[model samples]
Target chain A: MSRRTTLLTALGWLALAAALLGLAPALLSDFRLGLLAKYCCYAIAAVGIGLAWGRGGMLVLGQGLYFGLGGYAMAMHLKLTDAGPGQVPDFMVLYAGGEMPVWWEPFRSPVVTLLAILLLPVLVATVLGAAIFKRRVKGAYFAILSQALTAAFAILLIGQVKTTGGFNGLNNFQSFFGYSLYDPVNKRMLYFLAAGVLLASVALMAQLHRSRFGELLVATRDAEERVRFLGHDPANVKLVAYVLAAVLASVGGALFVPVVGIISPEDVGVGASIALVAGVALGGRASLFGPALGALLVGYAETSLSESFPGSWSYFQGGLFVVVVLLLPGGLAQALSALASVRHRVGGPPGGRRRRERPASDRTRPGPTTPQEVTA
Target chain B: MSVPGRDYLEVRGIRVEFDGFVAVDGVDLTLLQGQVHFLIGPNGAGKTTLVDALTGLVRATGLASYDNQNLLDRPSHAIVRLGIGRTFQTATVFEELTVLQNLDIAGGVHRRARSLLRRRRGVPERVHETLATIGLTEQADRPAGVLSHGQKQWLEIGMLLVQDARVMLLDEPVAGMSAEERRETGELLHRIGQERTIVVIEHDMDFVRDFADVVTVMSAGRVLAHGTVEEIRADPEVQRVYLGHTVEGVA
Candidate 1:
């Protein structure tokens, strides 16, 4: 990218960060702020999806597998910390009172819990993605496999009543890593944490988007056979994106536990996973900010629309998906770019800086990596 | 003819079967450097399947070795790393990427994963030279999908060139080219043919006769005749397989 474009992009991100991290606390209601924090967690995972599914062309239908891993890891530690030494968590005490399960013992250490949150999902995704990609199981077959695995994981969690709190999952944490959750200040800190993580993830994604690896990932998506003849292992390329997406989802899930104050099978099941993908498609999966913004839009819509109409939100979401896919295959981001270019043609000054080119998401040129590229 | 001790690709009894149908029966040929070797046969004579086996895109048995390394049974990607590349009958460049990106990716075989994540400093010297070689330097920034069909073919060939493929298997590269484009591609083959080995599967007899340094005729998955273009043109077996027709008549 030109130096000016790079500077403009960096400035755009800084302005967004100022709004999200510096100003949102003062602007939104506590309820809305908390909700935004939750949405930010989802955005983190969505950014990863953009890379893997959008750029790498791997339709990941079970990202909740990793999300659940991080959420449960955080929930376990919080629950254990809430219950003092040698004491069982309230849910376990109320249901199958005897001793803390052997597995729950490790989450007692904050370090261990954080480690588990980071490494466990990566471990699982590495194993699962390697197995799947190595076998060249892809497209709808891969999607079905991922979806089924998430379903089974949810079912397993529901069945483990004695250990995993069963269908109730894990909940009611009084503290988060020794910070009192009841305090408004700490809660706001948690929100800041989530927002900061989301922004950082976005910045990282922008770098990835313009990287040569990103170009290769798109190449692999378009022509896997041609990539092989180029002497590249397509599986490895895909695994990188898949595993990174898994890690991002895991981090999002970890933060989600504290922000939402709960972790359950319902939150990390096929429904949740597909909902995340829907948001990505709505925002433009191949775009750097599209996934994050799309996820936020979906989360916000679900909250507001579900409250107003109770049960109509699902139908509305379905309609939106169908319309966006059929009419705007590149999603809202592409439409935005299209609109900008049209405006430029009709009203822009002569010798305009912007070229009559396709959107950054579609082009592999050295343009701004952020969503601002639409305007740039 | 292959040099006695410097065979680039030596094949023996390479066969491919699907269920009970034999796609490619046991066949042997020696590909030598500095030559444009053409593989010509009737449809379903295993022209493509033979290339497929040699490139590890299909399951094949027997010895197909390059630089003493067996090409059979290795992964398709591993075969490419050993400096062998093949283009499909239809051009298969990454449509969404630019011409430069396509060649950059093809030439990036030697780059490690860590290095791939950084911004490309500039077009590598090799890619710049290849763009000029393929005459697509003007279209380097255009998305490959929007290129003309002939341009796409050149882009695919340019990709192999950037890949530094020592032995390239091209499947009907000029099948859909204009007369002028065909001539340019013929010159391209001869220009690069002096440094590498090339196996072109073509039905265009004029192209074959004009560019072939050697020709191997296949019939029913077997080598029916092997010699220079002139010798194969006069071979009686080739004549019979050509429906008792001449080379130009078959074309």
Candidate 2:
């Protein structure tokens, strides 16, 4: 990019920061502000999806696993704080009264909760990613494996009525840390925190996208064999992106607990995980701003559509995903590229020509979600 | 780490058997540094398979050694890191990336992961120099995907240059080219071949005759002939199997 384009992009980011940080809080009501905070969490998760599936070419279908780890870690601390010093959570009293599970004890500390929210998801993702990438399992197989793992995670939470809250999961938080939930001022602070984190995540990814590592990530995606012959391990390159994705999802889920006042299996199951992916795909997986904006739009649409037609909301979500996949798999940018041919992207991918050396049959072998060449 | 005129890549008893079909049967070829070695033979004579075996792309039982490390059994990436590189029959530069970015990524194998996370401050001097070497300085900003076929092939060679490859295994580098492009590529091979070991798996007899310092001929998964271009062309045994057609084709 030229110096002039770089200056304009910096200015554009500053303007967006102003709108998101200053303008949004002043404009929306408390309820609406809280909703936006929720959407920001989803956006955080979407950025990770973009890094993994979009650039790294690893379909991270089980981001909910990381999200849940962070959400539950935060919720555990909040629930423990609500229960006082000696007692277990209220759910234990109703379901199977007993001592606090040894595993949940660590999350009682605010420091531990924070660490868990960051490390737990990364740890799990690294283990899972290492196994999958080492075996070179990818495309639809990876997607299915991730989805199945998340489904199993949801099922495990539902079955553990004594420890976890079972089907209801964790909910009814009275406070976040020492801050009272009822205080509107504190609620606004939470919103700013989420928004700020979302911005920082975007900035961090933008930096990575411009970095040598980012270029290598794209190289590995397009030509894994070619990349291997270049002397850099594609598996290791992909693992870094996958780990970053898990960390982002984990952080998003942690913030989600305070902002939404709940952490539940329903929020980190296959449905929720797919919803996060849908938002990214709807936005434009490869574009920097597209994922976050797409997630916000999808979240807003979900709220509006669900309010009007609560029962038909699932059908709408499914239909939206189908349309995005079948018609516009390139996501919102595919539509926008027509209007603003310059469709500005933070991590403007090296667009033009896929693996030309690859047999034509192999490009579409994995199905519609395959990384099609994006020239624009 | 290489001394000119000494053995660089020593391959002994390298055999590739795919379900009872022996593709590369007991091949022993010692590639020496500072030599433009050409491996020329009929199609399916295990030339490509031999390169694959040496590069660790195929699981072959053999002693393929470089820098005292057994090249076989290690991964393809490891083989590259050991100062060995191979290009496919077709150009395989990352089509989406710019020519500069392609070389940058290829060159970065020697850099630390920590350094890679930061934005590239400026084009590295080595990468910049390589653009001139490959004659793609003007096309550096253009995505490699848009380069002309000959240019793409040069970019692939440029990638090996950036990789600092001590041994370069090129597969039919000038298969389709204008006479001018072929000449340019032949010149490129000469420029880079001065310090490194180059093994060109070629079908173009004229290219082999013009460029090869030492030529090895293979037939039916075996070494049919080995020595200078003149010796192989003069031998009656070589004439019967291969050179009978090759000398005619070139004429």
Model number with the top lDDT: 1
Q: Please report how far candidate 2 places residue B145 from its true position, in Å.
A: 1.6
Interface RMSD for candidates 1 onward, in order:
3.0, 4.1
As a TM-score, model 2 comes out at 0.93
B1-251, model 1: which lDDT tens digit per residue?
A: 33443347899999999998998889999888898999998888899999999998899998998877898979999999999989999999877677888888888898977898897778999999999999999999877878989899989889999999999999999998999999999999899888899999989999898889999999889999999988998888898988853354365
Which tens-of-lDDT digit does each residue in A1-376 have in candidate 2? 4578467657766776898899999999999999999999999999999888888888788899889998889999999998888878898888886666789888789998899888898789889889989889887888899999999999999999888888888989889989998899999999999999999888887788778888888778778888899998788999999999999999999999989998889999999999999899899887677788889999999999989988887899899988887778778865775445334322345554442323342332221243343211
Quality of candidate 1's docking, in CAPRI categories? medium
TM-score of chain B of each: 0.95, 0.94
lDDT of each residue in B1-251, candidate 2, tens digit only: 34623357898999999999999999999888889999988777899999999998888997988888898999989999999988888899877677888888888988987999887778888899999999999999877777888898899999999999999999989988888998899889999998899999988888888888999988788998899999988877777876454553242
lDDT of each: 0.87, 0.85
Give per-residue lDDT, candidate 2, residue A296.
90
Candidate number of the best DockQ: 2
TM-score of each: 0.93, 0.93
The C-alpha stretches of model 2 lying farther than 4 A from their native spots are: A342-376, B1-7, B243-251
Q: After superposition, how far is residue B194 of candidate 1 from its true place, in Å?
A: 2.1
The second chain of candidate 2 has a TM-score of 0.94
Candidate 2: clashing pairs of residues: none
lDDT of 1 at A212: 87
Per-residue error at B22 for model 2, in Å?
0.8
